[model samples]
Target: MSAPTEPSRTSDAPGRGPDPRAERSRAAALAAARDLLIEQGWSAVTHVAVAARSGVGRTTLYRHWPDASGLVRDVIAERISTAHTPPTGVLRDDLIRELDGLRRLLHDPVSDRGLRAVIERAGVDPVFARLKEALYREGSRVFRTVLDAAKARGELAADLDPDLAVDQLAGPLMYRRLLAGRAVTAEYVERVVDDFLAAHAPT
Candidate 1:
């Protein structure tokens, strides 16, 4: 009889945690994909191009992402799911900080281009539209959390709607930047933050 066979190795097997080197390679590929998307549009992102830019092998990228859309979904999801809200204790200050970050992002050439590409693609592609919707919902959670905290602390009305509030705060900046082709100046960002707080914050 053959010697007792060992258990098949699987990702969930003991001592089989993810490889750090593979993680680094994945990070590099993601970074390269993000840069290429921003600089040359989504059309420029391919397994070979990402591998070339990231210094990883094309096969490695293919094993992970399978296709360009898979990579795009991840890149967009990574950006849209997390919003940084500085904890200042003061709701107004926090809103200002968040909006100020948005202002700066809109002003960045790379970020601006990437954002525009996502928006434009979403308009015409159902797949991208779904991804965009997911992003929007996730992004809304940031403002929702802030609003909930403010409500709990008696800084905002208990009935304040977070979704509507976020739209009011973020919609103008995006519209002005993408549709109106106008710069979201620092002053403009401050005004929106102030206006939203004035209208919604508890007296």
Candidate 2:
């Protein structure tokens, strides 16, 4: 008779966790993908290119991502979702804190390039369009969280739309910093916060 079969090995099995080497490879591949995305545009990040740059085997990448979209999606998510500020219970202050974070991020040349690539590619590339949809869904989570808290505390109208608020708060910053190539100064941030508060004053 055949020998008793052993249970299939799984990462979730007791004492069986992610391999350090695999994790390192994944991090390296993501770094490579981010660099390629920013430096060479969205079309440059293929499995072969990423494997060549990251020194990770193509088979490994394919096993994990299955296609370039998976890899590119993750890189874009990381690019946009880098920071999250905890709420201070004051709506004005919270908005300022979040906008300031955006100001600083947009000011960085590397981040600026990445954001431009994402916007540009997402406009033209169908693959990036899908990724962009998924990204924008959750990218403003921190800002939404802050608004929800304000509504709960009677600091904002219950009927206010958080999605519109996100656009209102971030649209100016992007138009100025990215499109107009202007500096995002403290005064500009203040003006933005003031306008938003005026528009949506607490009941």
Candidate 3:
């Protein structure tokens, strides 16, 4: 991908405090960028394209997101953040809920492609690679929370590694849906949860 040419910063007036209009413009541009990624693919989310689609000034768009990947990173982050699983105080149920949320997100048309766009580029680009790492940290937060709660309640084996458990639960669903080209059914989710409980349940 070509580097985005730096755009000149433009402002309406010198501001000393928070600017709500700027926030709104940024939100609009991000929405437009996300739509472009889903509808047209990664190449269509450039600063110029986002500005045109969002009706925001190109300078403003570039000022916030210097390139397409920056826009993509924000979009992916926001999308991932929306899938919250309020822990039901049951370890198995919490893990299942989180994985199911992931399955639905992977199945969603918008996330299906928008996430892939950045993921596809992460291997070669350091910037995008960092973005992928950050996204992983975000996606794993729920697992970490649920696992911590379970371990505290003595519901899990004392020696179980929380991080590994997180991967164990989320990995298969993602692999089956994104890589193995298989259907991620509710039954599959339950089986995954059951297996996780079997392996990690307190002795």
Candidate 4:
């Protein structure tokens, strides 16, 4: 005899709240908010706009995110991990890999514009400024983790400050993007990685 067919899985299972449909709606709204922010800056992100772009009702977007800044904050927070890279054995290789990951993130048109928009808004909005500060900290986590691994592998001094090292590595990229208006290409990332490692490598 043939075996009985298994029950189909769905969002409507008993005792399961808000199911897959709700989750998909929420994700769609977030994606729409991100795209809007990238395409038109922070000013473009609103309840009505996100609702229209996401194909959900304004009430639903408003229910989950009361303010546009809250939605923007969530988007940026979720994207902080996009540039993360796992540790490699060699310190230089690890640093280069991390920088390369960053370069890819910056090269992504959506992320590039989204980041610039937030930075511009942060200059004038205190709420956005706070979120930006938190974002910077979150964005630095991967670098710190890589630094810790380098130290463990005897490639960096035990007393080398992880925060300072991360600043050294990321500062130039930000300067080029925000101040100098230079393209952060793979070559630029390699140079930044090399210069930082030359100065910080364990003696």
Best candidate per TM-score, number?
Answer: 3
Best by lDDT: 3
lDDT of 1 by residue, 1-203 (tens): 11111211121346776666776777798789889888888888888889889998887777677667677666655554345765677787777777777777777765576567678888877757876676566556557777788999988877888878998999999999989999888789889988888888676
lDDT of 3 by residue, 43-161 (tens): 78899888888999987776777666778767766665546758889877888888888888888866777668768888987767876676678778888898888888999888889
- lDDT, model 1, position 191: 93
With a 3 Å backbone cut-off (N, CA, C), the pairs that clash in candidate 2 are: none
Judged by whole-model lDDT over C-alpha atoms, candidate 1 comes out at 0.73
lDDT tens per residue, model 4, 22-109: 6787789889988987888777889989988999788767767767777776666666555565666677777778777767767666
Better of 1 and 2 by lDDT: 2
Q: Which residue pairs of candidate 3 clash? A: none
Indicate the TM-score of model 1.
Answer: 0.71
Candidate 2's C-alpha runs over 4 A off are: 1-14, 108-134, 148-161
How many clashing pairs does model 4 include? 0
Clash number for each model: 0, 0, 0, 0
In model 3, the worst 10-residue window by lDDT is 1-10
Query: What's the ranking of the predictions by TM-score, best on top?
Result: 3, 4, 2, 1
Residue 80 local lDDT, model 4:
53
